[model samples]
Target: MTKQEKIDSFDPNGPASGNRIFGLPFSQKDAEIVILPVPWEVTVSYDAGTALGPEAILEASKQVDLYDPFVKDAWKMGIYMAKLDPKVIEKNRKYRDKAVAYLSAVEVGHEDETTDELLAKINKSCKKMVNWVQERTTELMNEGKRVILLGGDHSTPLGYLEALAKEHEFGILQIDAHADLRNAYEGFTYSHASIMFNALKIDNVKKLVQVGIRDYCEEEVEVIEASEGRVKTYFDRDLKHQQYAGATWKQQVDDIISQLPQKVYVSFDIDGLDPKLCPHTGTPVAGGFESEEVMYLFERLSESGKTIIGMDLNEVAPGPHDEWDANVGARLLYRMANLFGKNAGVVG
Candidate 1:
């Protein structure tokens, strides 16, 4: 069947088939939005399992209903996720074991030649992963397809950001629990904790606006302060205080949206949401936004006339015997895809 026939015949409320993202029937060539899955999470400091996030989300996405009230007939816009590379997954396991040992040694103040060698190897592997992602994303962009990066960790988007920088000058809207500003965190250059710091090095990233940040180190604070308006952070505590002082969420959202450039790239770490929504994420911090709150903000962003050039959803680890985290991630992914498609004029 042609793409239109598949869309017209597919039941929005029916069971999702195996083998495709959100159980959609479209292939890569016909899909308006293409998602690249990066299943590598070697530098995560807190938890393990995020390397499995892409598969988990793919499984959970099958349960998602295609009908979206926010964007009418959102499923009409073809969305397809590329297959995850098994080689990357194997690489993640290899380096993750090394990273675990290296972090263990560091925790006990055991800094020795063996640890240094392991760290160097892990860093080199991470650089290769970045390059792999960059090449894939660049290829997709060259095809004139809007991309959404499905990630293994917060660090997964670094290469996607690099690929985007080559084509567009845009600001980043980071929704996360931490500042992710550590330089060479735990001796790993591409540590998940240093994504924003690495992102800042890109010449085309004009600004970075972070929200729902409740956990960060003094060093990260220094970087945010030092940026001199290049980086704008809305700490979770201050936002709560503002709400307590009678400021509406809509008002705060407006204020947050006002800081972004006309073109924006959304980097969403699942830990940015309340822990109840993502209990398995790597770093679970207290006091975060509700799912609807963040969705409302995204809706506002869409209505504000800002173009969502690209996006990524990251750090969504699944719990053993439970699919809650992936379920949330899948729904959020659908929402983000719909919003990006609508903004790009591909979906109505």
Candidate 2:
């Protein structure tokens, strides 16, 4: 069927169909935006299950309403998420066990030859994951499709950033609870805790602006201080204090947006929101922005004339008995897809 015919036949408010993201009837070639699902989570420091985030979000996305007040007829933009690669999933499972053992040894201050070998293997596997993401994203970008990366963890974006660096120079606007600037949290070079550290190594990433950060270590603070304005952090405590002192969210959001460059890449970790919204996320923090609060920031970002070159949402792990995390992730994905489509001029 023609694209128009498919749209005409689609029931936006009806029950969601199975398989496709948002239950949309559009192939990769027909979609304006393509999402890469990275199902590797070998380095999560705390809980697991984020490797299943892409699949869970896909299932929950079927319930999201297509109408958006912010972007009219947003579903027409054609957002298609790539299927999860089974090879990557298998690698994640394999390295995750090794990572667990490595972490246990480190916690006990036991550094043996076996630990060294395990660490080496885990790092090698992670680098392979990065390479895989870069190759796929490069293909999608070359196809003239805007991309959204659905990740197993924050570390998943390093490869995506690498691919973007080859094409455009952009700054990252990171929304997360942790600083993610540790050199190597658990002796793993590509550990999730070291994502921002690895990201800074990219020449095309000019600046890093972080918000909703309430949990971090002294080393991360030192990294931020040492960045010499290259990194700007808006601590959650400070933002709350500002609000308590009569400063509106709009005022704070404007300040945050001012620190970003003209070209922006949004890195959203589910833990950036209040724990109530993502209790089962890989790492749950105490304080965070409301969903709409972050959404408003995105809207202001678009209105500020900054180009959102690319984006990724990570660290959403669903509960065994509940679908809350995936539900939120799916809705957030939908909103971001629409925002990206509108920014790219693919949606009216």
Candidate 3:
């Protein structure tokens, strides 16, 4: 059988043993790509089940067409998929259950030991998750591989972000429905709501430019205001108003890009797209970037000579029957791989 047929025979859940679209052994070095599946969704405030996102994306990736119109020969870059760590899965479940209970309660800051204990458990587990990811990312970087992290949620990239920080000072191009600037949401230090806030804490993060922000609290606004120019937000409200008044999205994209630094790390939460593509994502805001616009944004970034050091496409969930989000995510990942390949001079 051919390589594709061999991979088709390896899927444990499917009819065969190695039916993965990308094939088995999951290790590809020539492509200069390391795909880390972080099966974490514990700190997700609104919805559950993102813990199942990475595997679903992987399964759906089998159906992804290798030909990318924008970046030719992107598939030649070896795409390496790392197996999901079982300990992270166990930790994610424990924290997910704890978060559900914590969020369901009336009094949030109840000075009780149970709350404290749960908080401790979640934080400790998250630290372990972050540290392991950091170590893995650093190892990959040292091996001269570009990394694309598949997330359990937005927060899954924190460790990888730290790893990137050590090597280069880069800016963040965050695409999400929410600002994710909350210091700590519902007493969860590593909450999805605080991903950007944590990034802001990193000294190496030059600037954080967030787009598609439509959900946030008064507290989050205050924090953004305090951040000054360090965090530049392109609010959906304002962007829509601009579009309503005849300003094109391209103009808006230009405005957003003006605030970024030279080197960029794209943090693309699938929720940043219209809800139709990802109805089951952790949080679904009313307004978001259309997939086309996001693609254009990446294209523009690439054309502008800004090196995309690393990126994460997270919070993509598979629906009951549809594989739309992963379908989109797989394409995004391929596009990003091409972009990284070009930046690293791997793809000519």
| Candidate 1 per-residue C-alpha lDDT over 103-136 given as tens digits, one digit per residue, 9 for 90 to 100 | 9999999999988899999999999999998999
TM-scores vs. true structure, each candidate: 0.98, 0.98, 0.90
lDDT of each: 0.93, 0.93, 0.80
**Higher-TM-score candidate among 2 and 3?**
2
What are the clashing pairs of model 2?
none
Which residues of candidate 2, in runs, are more than 4 Å off? none
* Residues 125-205 of candidate 2: C-alpha lDDT, one tens digit per residue: 999999999999999999999999998999999998999999788899999999999997878899899999999999889
Indicate the worst ten consecutive residues by lDDT in candidate 2. Answer: 10-19
User: How well is each residue in 1-348 modelled by candidate 3, as lDDT tens digits?
Assistant: 544553454342333125443543335454368888899988887777677888887787766666667766555555777778898888888778877776666265555777778778878878888898899889888888888998888889999999999989999999999988888787778888899999888999989998988988898889789887888888888888999999998888887877778899999998888898788898887878778889888877877777889989899877777877777777677677677776666764
What TM-score does candidate 2 reach? 0.98
How displaced is residue 224 in candidate 1, in Å? 0.7
